[model samples]
Target: MTGEPFKLGDRERDEIKWSCGAGLGLLTRYAPGDFTVTLRLQPENEKRDRLDLGLLRKPQEDSDIGEGHETWVPLIKNVTSFEISYFDPNANTWLPRWPGAQLPRLVKVKVGRSDTAVPWEAIIPLRRTPY
Candidate 1:
């Protein structure tokens, strides 16, 4: 399960790089639990990427204390990036994430260009009304 759409900015791009460099992707899942969101990010690029799968959800009566209404708990974010790269301010080198996300806001396919510094199928799981 993926998400709707969430744009990526310099801040987000940087976050996903240093934090989850390898599995640098954001995927959402509409599971049958509290948080139905999963942000994929791999701090390293490897063959068998790792998964740091997490869940995102609003606040519930049994929810944690400090957590806000909209929060994401990383679950599968340890996967290695087979193609994506960060925006290097040093050599001016740059790469883009693969189209494995569920971003419906992007221009479907990123035409031309050898790389993209942003997410493709960006996952933005729709928030459900807490029961």
Candidate 2:
């Protein structure tokens, strides 16, 4: 789960600092469903050194109407430096952020710890279809 030929930019370094500072991160997840889920790292205490990974769910109907509720469900704890990237098939490149109607060919997630050198990462493939 760890190891990589990875590079860090100003943006990435800032993100790492922000995540560690607030002990929070936002992770996007796409699926064939009526709702959307975003995974987030939230601080477990006021110290902001420890965090919990959680999912925030919101129904499409609510988002469209602008009058609905969201639910937060925690998954894991003591997480840090969570980052994500999307691979655009059209552009044939990886992007730091995804904001398109079509699904990206691949989704890459990276998680790091303050105590470790290389971060843990995963590249997940998605259907090449438009939503």
Candidate 3:
């Protein structure tokens, strides 16, 4: 996908909040299989003092539910960058997986918050990798 900066409206931000709270992860069946995930964190935001971000995977569709499993990777605070990619077993390399004609899957974003009255957690359903 292209490296472009997009603005999030109130509704969009609200949706993200709901999804995070829902704990089901973000489901993305949108277009453009390949893309970049960029989050600009402003620590000065009144709602939150710190934010933790990480990736989680659901091993199986029917078996796992709600934040299936947390990867060994540690969550990051303040600001961070990540790329989602799929392992191409045949090619013996990792490739960028994009959303196409496939059932929507949940990509969980393990969010940790501190010093906030309201907890904003979210999961991202990704059809592609970060690349």
Candidate 4:
């Protein structure tokens, strides 16, 4: 709510509240140590884009995701559009900006690829919440 604005890569929004914390993955129960995964969209060309995943070993206390030794891995390529939405349980609605300390109940990712005519979408539910 404060600062310049919330920016996801080049796009910016002033309504979303950004927080700093660590989150567990699907292998958190089987594995150990803090695991954080950050997804970002990088432009491949003027009309296309690519999705990149950043892996962090330690927890970050600040808003910046570049605190520890992170690895950038390409997850998908030839992405024409990438959109993320957070489901707010209290509001019973999906929002573009996930604003709060607690994690969203469901995270939705929609991707449009150049190779395919139909867009791909996925709705992932988070098992853990800060509350």
Q: How much does each candidate deviate from the true structure in C-alpha RMSD?
A: 14.0, 10.0, 14.5, 6.9
For residues 1-131, write the lDDT of model 1, one tens digit per residue: 22223233321221121111112232333333333233333233345534333434442333456645655555434422222233323344433442334322221221111145543443222333133
True-structure lDDT of candidate 2 = 0.55
Which structure among the candidates has the greatest TM-score? Answer: 2
Positional deviation of residue 99's Cα in model 2 after best superposition, in angstroms: 1.1
TM-score of each: 0.21, 0.59, 0.24, 0.55
Assess the local accuracy of residue 75 in candidate 1 as a C-alpha lDDT between 0 and 100: 46
* After superposition, candidate 3 runs with Cα above 4 Å error: 1-23, 26-76, 102-131
Could you tell me which 10 consecutive residues in candidate 4 have the lowest summed lDDT?
12-21
Per-candidate count of clashing residue pairs (backbone under 3 Å): 31, 0, 16, 0
Write down the TM-score for model 4.
0.55
Instruction: Tell how far residue 25 is off in model 2, in angstroms.
Output: 18
Model 2 scores a TM of 0.59
Candidate order, lDDT descending: 2, 4, 3, 1
Candidate 1 vs candidate 4: the lDDT winner is: 4
Ranking by TM-score: 2, 4, 3, 1
Alpha-carbon lDDT, every model? 0.32, 0.55, 0.32, 0.51
